[model samples]
Structure formats: C-alpha cells, structure tokens
Target chain A: MADAALRRTPLHDLHAGLGARMGGFAGYDLPLSYPAGVMAEHLHTRAAAGLFDVSHMGQVILRGERAAEALEALVPVDVLGLAEGRQRYALFTNEAGGIEDDLMVANRGDHLLLVVNAARKEADLELLRAGLPESVTVEPLDRALLALQGPGSEAALAALAPGVAGMRFMDVATVTLEGTEAWVSRSGYTGEDGFEISISEKAAVRVAEALLAQEGVAPAGLGARDSLRLEAGLCLHGHDIDAATTPAEAGLGWAIQKVRRTGGDRAGGFPGANRILRELAEGSERRRVGIRPEGRAPMREGVELYDSADALAPVGRITSGGFGPSVGAPVAMGLVPAALSEPGTRLHAELRGRRLPVTVAALPFIPSNFKR
Target chain B: MKYTEEHEWLRPEGDLVVVGITSHASTQLGDVVYVELPEVGTVVTQGDEIVVIESVKAASDITAPLDGEIVEINEAIADEPGKVNEDPTGDGWFFKIRPTDMSQLDAFMDEDAYEAMTG
Candidate 1:
C-alpha cells in the first residue's frame, strides 16, 4: 500500500518528528527505522531500553456475563477459568485446524480484553462478532499502545508509576501514569523485561513523551522490534502462523492450556478441537522450527530447505528470516518435516541455487529475559 | 562517470571501472552486516545483479552498472561489511569490472544529475 493509503496511528507525528524511516506494513505507514538505525536500536533495547509505538495493534473488549464462555467457543484456549489481572496467549482456529489469528487474551476484571494483530483486526472482529452469542457485546478501544522494553524498563517505568514494579510477568494492571489512567501489562513481545502500556488516544502523546524523556529509553521502529522478536523465538502472525497452519504444527501447542484439551473440564468445544487434539496426541507432520544458517550470507524468507546438496530431498520453506543483530548471525524460522526438526540436525537451505548448510537449533536464538 | 536509478555508481578507474552503491543508497539501507560478492572472472551484463547486501533489516541486490567481466571484488567489505556504509564510493566499492563497451557509461546520470533526480 502507498503511504497515503495507509492509516496513521496517534503517535505518527511524534515518529515523524524523530525522523523515522517509514515503510508500509500491516496497512500502516509505520517506522521501519530511526536515525540511530535498526542495529543500534536493537542492541540498545536489549542492553538498556527501547520504547516502541505499537498503537496500530488492535485493542478490543468482549463484554457480558457469558464473555469468557462465549470466547472459548471461538478460540482453543481456556478463557472461562482465567483469573482476573492475568493474561494468556491464545489463538483463534478455523474448522479445518488452520489459525485465523494468534492473540493475547487478558481477564481485565470487568471484561475479557483481546489484543489481536493489527493487519487482521477487522477479520478477527468479524469472526468474534459472528461466532459469539447474542449476550456478548464487542467493543473496540480507540487506544494507543506503547511498549517499554529492555532490562532497564522496570526502573524507568517505576520512576513514573511505582505500582508497575509489583506486577509479575504476564500481569495486567490498570495503573495511573501521573494521574492518567492506563492499562499497563507486565509483558512484551521482545522477550525482554518490559511493559505494554495501553492508554487512550487522547493521553497517548503525554505518556509517550514521558517515557521517551526518561533515561535508558530510545524509540525503536518495526525493524528492531522484528529482529528482537525473531531472536526471542516469537512468531509473527501472518508469516509464521496463518490460515494454512494449525497451532500444533506451528509449535504453538503450548498456547492451548490443558483445561481445553482432552480430559479437562471444558474439553473439545472449540473449532478444530478434534484435529488439534489429535495432533497434540500424535504430532503434526511438519513442525515450525528454528533455522541457523552457518555463514555470512543470510538465508531469506521463501528459501527452500533441502536434505541434501543435490536438491533432491526437499524438506520445507522459510517463513521469516533475518540477521539477528544480538545473536551476531543469521537466524530464521520455518516449517520443516518433523523428522528433521530436532536440534543439531544438519540441513541444507537452498540459497541462490546453492545448498547452504543450516543447523536445526532450538527456537529463540537468544535466551528470553522476561521478568518471571 | 554516472549513477544508475538503482543507486549504484560507476566510475572509470584506468582500464577497469569501479562499481558500488552510492552513499545515499547506503544511508537508506542502514547498518550493512553482510555482503555477497560474485567470484572474480565472472561475466555479467549491465542491469544484472552482481552483489547482495544484507542489513539488519532486509537484503538488497546491487546491479551491474555496465556490461562487463568481473575483475575484482572488495574482499575487505566481505570481512567488514560496515565499510559499504562508511565510504560507499571509495573503499566500499563492490567490484572492479572491465566493461565490454565503454560507451554504456554515457547512459547513466552524472553526479549533479543524479543528486537532483534523487533529491
């Protein structure tokens, strides 16, 4: 999409002021880099702190008495038993075992809050609207989301909102920032200790400015955010898990809690539960695994993976691949045959017609530093 | 002598002309971490991709400026890819190509023309 056609977030002007290298992504003309660039931004985030404007992400509220039970009918997770102020990673599956979208469901006391992918917001909402019962009311929050991610994040946030320090990883609290009400979650996608602050569009600029003015906080664009997540072994929705991929095959079987799986209290009520449960018992044929190419030439997405140098034995394809700055090498994740998905298994990723040696390593090229 | 729309620069250096991405191109690319150069003695035509540069974000191809046979590639860049961003037109030059037809250099835009076009 052209820049003019793309939607602008509340903090678009702030990014423009900071001279962000904007690109068209997820139907938005968001920043791809800053003046400091991606490498510096990525390293800074891991070492110190990085604040990202994730306002383009969708914030939704599922209301009513049957909210949790109604949500369970659409997703494969056990939302019905979710404790207040806690969040769980969940996915909405189709009837054929493919994922519509992977999301974050938080039981925010009064309502079940969902954070869906920015690109798939409308479709996800449509599914939620059409799939749920009449008692449930779907509300879209016009909010700006900012992520304060890194080792120094807690300190920076504590300086402003002291209550944020007490929250554990995956904990959600509606805290006040200088008296401005905001929903602060002790969670982030960067695999670092940080918080995702959800504030109204009216208060977005104030909160962002405050965070940026703090020490050890630099503005990171989507480029650094991507490399951070990739190194953390986190999957980008459309690229890694999509309508063609099931949670079991995508290595996201963990997202489905035991309460919704076989032999649990609320078992087998959601879409594709049969196929997913069966895959959970008997593993899927193709598994999403991490790929580590052993050279300077970074293997990119759509690169074919072969078992031999002769290109005879085809295994899989790269979904997302990039140079992991922190890891100091190229790291990629792709869907490959379950037989060859074991760690330390030597595989060949066909790059430029040459079979480049790639090793099947564990997901997350770097260890996650989340505040558990 | 001239620049391509793809942001590659071509300048005659004795019998062999040097080819590299322009400084503007490097700035836009940001923090080049790796470079893939073709082997010496390879034959390439103008507009044919000759080098691949991977940054922290994405990979981009550097096209040949003129129909030429590859004489040399910058080995220093292969070891220290950041040189491409530091001195794009000098030490960061991607390759030295012996152009088959010297007249092709006239087709590209000169420095003043290229700057105005990009600006």
Candidate 2:
C-alpha cells in the first residue's frame, strides 16, 4: 500500500525520530526495522527487551449479562470458564470449520477485552455485532497497544508499573503505567516474558519513551516481530492460518478446552462444531508442520512441497518461511499430508525449479520462555 | 569502474572484470543470509539471471551484465553472505568474468552518472 493512503500509528513520529525504516503493513505505515536492522533487532529481542508499536491491531470490549456464554457461541473455546484477570487465545470460526481470525480474549472482571489482527478488525467487529445479542455492547476502543518483550522485559516494565512484575503468563490487569492507567497483559506473540499495554493514544508516546529509556529495552519493528513469532511457532493470521484452515489442521486444538469438546457440558454449539469436533476426534487430512531446509538457501512462502524429488505434483506448500535470527538458520511452516507430518519425515521443496531437501521438524525452532 | 542499472559495480582487473553490487544495493538488501553464485567457467549472456541473493527480508537476483565466461567465483561470499553487507564493493565481490566483447563495458554508467542516477 502507498504511504499516503496507509494509516499511521500513534508512534509514527517516535519511530521516525528513532530512524526506523518505514513500510506499509495492514493498511498502516509502520516501522519495518530500525537502524539496528532486522537481524540485529531480532537478536536484541531474544537477548534483551524490545518494545513494539502494535497500535494497528484492533481492540474491542464486550459487556453484558452472560457475555462469556454469548462469545462461546462464536468460538470453540470455553469462554464462560475463563477466570477474571486471565487471558485465553481464541479463534473465530466460519460455518465451514475454517478460521475467520485468531484473537486474544481477556476477562477483565466486568467486561471482556479482545485484541484482533489489524486486517481482520473490521470484519471481526461486524461478526461480533451481528452474532451477538442487542443487549451485549461491542465497543471498539481507539487505543494504542505497545508490546514490551524479551528476558529483560519484566525488569523494564516493573520499573514503570510496580505490580506488573508479579503478573504471571497470560495474566491481565488494569495498572498505572508511567502514571497512565492502562490495561496490561503479561503476554506477547514472542515466546518471551513480556507485557502488552493498551493505553490512550495521547499517552502512547510517553509510555513508549519511558519503556525505551529503561535499560536493555530497545525499539523493534514489524520485521523483528515477525521473525520472533516465527521462531516461537506462533501462526500469523493471514499466512499460516486463514479462513480455509481449521483449528485442528493448524494444530490449535490445545486451545479448545475439554468443556467445549464432545461429551462435555457445552459441546458443539460454535460454528462448524461438527467438522471441527470430528477433525479433533479423528484427524485432518493436511497438517501444519515445522520445516527445516537442508542447505543455507532459504525456502520462502509459496514454495511448493513435493513428496519426492521427481514428483510431478506438489503435496503441500510453505505458508511462512524465513531466516530465524535466534535459531541462526532458516525455519519454515507448511501443510502436508497427515501421514507425512511426523518429525523427521523427508520432503522436497521446489526452489528455482530445483527440488531442495527439507525435513518436517517439530514446531518452535527454539524453546518457549513464557513465565508460565 | 562502471555501474549497471541493477546496482552492480564492474571493475576491470587485468583482462577480466570483477563484479559486485554497489553499497546502495547492499544497504537496500539488508543483511544478506545466502548467496548462490554461478559455476566458474560457465558461459553467460547479457541479462541472464546468474546470481541469487537471499536477505532476511526477501530474495533477489543479480543478472549478468554482459556476455562473458565466468573465470573465478568468490566462494567466501557463498559461505559467509554477511560480507556482502559489510563490504559490498570490496571483499564482497561476487565473481570475475572474462568478457567476450570488452566494448559492452562502455554501455554502463560511470561513477558520476551512476551517482546521479541513484541520487
């Protein structure tokens, strides 16, 4: 997208002042990298704290009687069982068992807060308004979300928000950050101990500046964010998991609680429950798996995967692929036949008309460091 | 020294030409991770895609600037691709080619012209 037509985050000036290289992503003219470059920024995040401007993501609040029960009707997760001050990863499913969008739902005692992908925010709002009862209020907040992630993230954030250091993984709370009341969640896309702080647009710059001023905290951009998430094996909404990908096929069945499964108290109520439950019980035809290319050449997305070097047709294709700065090598994720999804299974990815050897490895090239 | 529109810098060394991308190109590529160079002694034509460079952000190609035979290959860059980003015009040279027609070098831009075009 053109820069003039794209939306600017509240931290656009801050990023520009920090010498970040700007690019368009999800209708926003955001920072792709800083002067430190993507490789360095990624490594910095893995080693220390990296602050990110994720205001482009959508934030919404749902409030009403039986709000959790109403939300359970849209997603397969057991929302009603979610405890206050805790967060759960959820996905909106279509009638055909495909994922509409993956989101984070936090139970904030009286109301539930949702953080959805930027590109799907509008569609998700429409889904909420149409599927939800008139009594339930779906309020979209014009807020700025900043993510502070890495090993040093706790120390950095604790300096600003005193009680945040005590928060466990996936825990959410309304805290005063740098004297600004913000919703703070001890969770992030990177597999690191971090916090996602939702603050007003006016306070965004001040909070971001405060975090960056802390020791070991540096400014990161979308490029580093993508690399970090890929190493953590987290799926990008549009790339790894999309409308055609079911929760089972994407290996996200762990997010579905037993209460929402078959033979439970509230089972098969969400959209495409029949197909999703069946897939959960039996299995899906194609499964997403981690792939490691044999050589230095990186096999990127859209690369066709074949069962054999001489195969006339491809059995699967890579969805997300890149050079993992933390892993010090190239890592990828792709869909293949269920039978061939096991780790150590050999597959061939076509690159420049030549079939390159790749192995189906376990997900998350690096072990996760979540506080949990 | 001459430069191609594709950001490749050609420097005459003996009867052969040493080819590498300009600093501007390397800065744009941002942290190259892998480089696939052509085989030494392979005959190439002008505009033929010969070198494949993979950076952290994306993959790109360095096409042949003139009809020539690959005389020598820089194997160091193939092993350590980051050198291209460190010193794109010096130690990061991709290959040395013996041109069939030396007159083709005149078609490329000079230092001032290349700087103007890139500017």
Candidate of highest DockQ: 2
Best by TM-score: 2
Deviation (Å) of A278 in candidate 2:
0.6
Top candidate by lDDT: 2
Tens-place lDDT digits, model 2, residues A1-372: 236899998999999899998998889999999988999989999899899999999999999999899999999998998999999999999999999999999999999999999999999999999999988999999999999999999999888878988899999999998788999999999888899999999999999999999999999999899999998999999999999999999999999999999998999899999999999999999999999999999888899999999999999999999999888889999989999999999999999989999999998899999898
Residue A22 of candidate 1: its Cα lDDT? 90
Per-residue alpha-carbon lDDT of model 1 for A1-372, expressed as tens digits?
Answer: 236889998998899999998998888889899999999999999999999999899999999997999999989888987899999999999999999998899999989999999999999999999999889999998899999999999999999999989999999999889678989889998989999999988888889999999999999999999999999999898898899999888999898889888988888888898999999989999999999999977777899999878868678988998888999888999999999999988889888778889999998889899878
Off by over 4 Å in 2: none
> Going through the candidates in order, what fraction of the true interface contacts does each contain?
0.95, 0.95
* Model 2 CAPRI rating: high
DockQ of each candidate, alpha-carbon based: 0.84, 0.94
lDDT of 2: 0.94
Residue A314, candidate 1: C-alpha displacement in angstroms? 2.5
Q: Residue-wise lDDT of candidate 1 within B37-103, one digit each (tens)?
A: 9999999987788788998877888888788899998999999998998899999999999999988
Could you tell me the lDDT of residue A158 within candidate 2? 89
> How many residue pairs clash per model?
0, 0
Instruction: State every prediction's TM-score relative to the real structure.
Output: 0.97, 0.99
